[model samples]
Target: MTTDAYDHAAVCELLGAWAVHALPPSEQHAIPRHLADCADCAAEAERLRETVRLLDGPDAPTAAAEPGTAARNEPNPMVMSEPTPATRNAALARILAVRPPAPRTAPHAEPYAAAVAALRALLAELDPQPDGGPDLAAWRTPVIHDWTVQDTVAHLIAADEHLAAHLGLPANHPQDPQGAAAPGDTDWRTAWDTRTHRVIAHERTRPPTATVATWRAQASALLACPAANDPELAARAATLVGVRLPVAEHFLIRAFETWIHADDIGRALGRPVPPPPAAHLWRLVRLAVRILGLALGPTAEPVALTVTDAARSTEWILGAEGEPVRAELVLDPVDFCLLMGGRLAPEAVPRAALGDEAAVRTVLGRAARLAWL
Candidate 1:
């Protein structure tokens, strides 16, 4: 048995033996002394014992059992726990390094990339109408300050190309706007906005011949970006505000933009524009709710979401208008997407779905109050 120099984890393990009457006095006596002095060790002991009890109880386990047996009061051969500080500090260090994901009850994230890929393929297959092509007439909107589908396609492709320049694109990329003569070209905003609209006009005049094929390739490629797999990935210091994001995230956000634009044109064109599959829809809504929370702040309580079709539920906790976001509601995948896209109404959302009602509305902000379809 060790003395005062024992590590916390070993001490915790020893205490388990003592509770069950297996730890010898050499290790056992120090445990009581340590627990008396160390709050962290005591809490850990309590949690571990609770874990073992839950795991070993008769109603819980189907397998041959262990841990419930009485302890042999011998000086345990198992190393004595050195009740010390390293135990907690080590765990904290690992947490800080990995920034591990919080526990999630869902089986898997909705597959956004796959959904985008399918949309891309569908866009590719549409045969143009006899009037030279699928006319842009269906996309024109009378609304104030919103983008159309044509403008969307152009923007997604062009904006990424432009920002990719500072993030490591080749000098010959198509994002270079200023044809060497635009005023205040040095201001990145002026250059990007001017060139973005210019490209939008140019692409509108000569839309991509294999629109779907181009999008499919674009969407599929985004899955391989560095940011998607690594949480610690940070954008280059030189990037602009909206531009400081990973490529996979960028692709998904673009998918949101694309889908919204699709709805816009579809409403005008009078045709059904189905959203992505069940899984991807969940991720889309999940991302939107999270970003909205981050952009704003945490609400008082949790908000619940229910996807009408898949029956998947999500929960989010947002603070105030400008505070960090928390997942306080469980929502349905499809409904969540519709809610965020300037479409579905708040009244349509299942209030009971969110465990906390008052906090939900506050976090959703004006987006929840709109009366659109």
Candidate 2:
């Protein structure tokens, strides 16, 4: 109802649309006044606004040349015209000039940097203001689990904290107040979940913008760390999140999870987020395949896993080696990554398979199980 006595649940349902300015004028005007007196609504609104800011990128004209350059009556090709390659390049250059792209890093760390930048661009679309700032009221939109959009971001701060500390960056928020984990508590999942719950709860008390700032700041610091820039530095292995791997591989894991969660957030907002760049997508595919192989272990029955894209097809033998391949499975690069990310059900994901269904199902099942996101 577009009135002061609005049903809270109904109003909450509209927050996503409201944040994007999709509601009618009467509803738009009423929601803000309603927010003013409702503390819960106000906090949720603020969080949505902050999430919107992350979606924004520098502005550039979509079409047409400088003002007055086009003749008034003559058919102006620039009007409603697709930009030429040169024009597109120029626009991209301008965007970079206004807001520089992610920092350069070693090959292993490149995807993480790019994914971070991509998420920032995606989040900007929530509620872009005329002044080029974001002010959406959509943060309360449900994403994964019971987490709202704001909570998803706060979870990221918690998720990335382990890697951040591994890289020698200081933790932005203090440890969960529940208690110092028992000395013998070696379960990374329990620890990870605890910290995420704590961080999300803590972040809920503050403006959504503050939580975003903390997440972005920590990410920037991680990118700036020497390990991110130096292949040798990142080569040193350290166990984090229950896996022992080189820091470089861990960086790729970060990129993988960030992209996955960003996609989740986009889905919650009714936006279709594109997959990561081709090269980056492939890197994720390879890493996921390797991890899936490990999870399947060396003694299990082998499956011929082939990941293909427009440019090339790469194959791997998963499970035990000496025996003839029992099955051949083919997947699109993105589909494979999504499967590993746990975004797609193994049975539901598109694929081409030949040979034993049991072996195929095994690979798919293992891949889905690997999804911790």
Candidate 3:
């Protein structure tokens, strides 16, 4: 870490933004020069940049358009020329140089894999302290529900425990003294909450680095499992979080919560957490809608639900199977996720609605209740 004039800690914290081309000009100019002399930063930078590449997929166009160039006919300087196979391979080689190849995942698991990568990218921004401890200030920053950054990571460990155990991974923490309650048990939510608190309590007694390592090791094991790379294996259903869903849908659920909590941590640390890649975001959106429909059930009044982003709008009719749609409701996809994640109050979330107000309320309330995160 030999960038003489730049504060190394600040520089390291900005690496995630730099890799995503999100930094302002002054910050961007310092990174490359710093990376030339700093081996650790350089290696971490390559990993974060590679993570972004995977999220965007190999053939997706780079963000080359200039901020104000939408009105211009000239080629945008922001966009890079499309990569040839040779170039793509060279990039992959660079990724391999810095870390092991990312695990192969089928379409269903891809979002979860990319999400794990995204969280890694965010965590990489926390430069180590002078005494060789994890960055305690950043790790202690408060996130949602009285959780510090490290506690949130611990909670994720507990959240993923059921699925991991179902797939034959060993438990990451000791079982409750009374006994580990199955997901099918009558008091499952209590069991789940108790486990999360227990994990957080135990993790608080260890170094933050230890907590992070524990979380990462479990996440890696989950991704390396056969079901993560095979659709047929993920087709098998298991009950977790008090709901029975296929392993594939469970993977998406993992991706959803990971990104949401990452966003929570980012806000606490005063950094921005980019939403998942568009395709991944859509996967989460579709999943939330399906779950919402199920919660609404067959006999409730029908509402036409539309979720939108800049590129498109997707519509679904919720409630009674044969009834005419009694009301229409619209919400942005990100807002919908936040709503379902319990970060947004149903009444406070931005939306457009018409026809029966009560019907729309039922959908929004049910969606909010769906959140266990």
Report the C-alpha lDDT of model 1 over 1-373, residue by residue, as the tens digit: 4576666644543443343223344544566567757787676555544443343344422222223534555323222323222332232222222221111112221143433332332232222344335444543432223555555555555544543443343322243434411322346556656666666666666545433334434443443344434444522233332334443454455556556655454454443456565455666776676666555544443333333444644444454544443344544555566666656667665434324455556554545532121
Lowest summed lDDT over 10 consecutive residues: which window, candidate 2?
91-100
Clashing pairs in 3: 64-78, 64-79
lDDT preference between candidates 1 and 2, better one: 2
Candidate that scores best on lDDT: 3
Ranking by lDDT: 3, 2, 1
Q: Who is ahead in lDDT, 2 or 3?
A: 3
Candidate 3 vs. true structure, TM-score: 0.75
lDDT of 1: 0.44
TM-score of each: 0.47, 0.72, 0.75
lDDT of 2: 0.72
Worst 10 residues of 1 by lDDT: 98-107
Give the per-residue lDDT of model 3 (tens digit) for 26-60. 44555776776778777787666656566557676
lDDT of each: 0.44, 0.72, 0.76
Instruction: Report how far residue 5 has shifted in candidate 1, in Å.
Output: 71
Model 2 Cα lDDT, one tens digit per residue, 286-334: 8888888989998878899999988989999999989889999999999
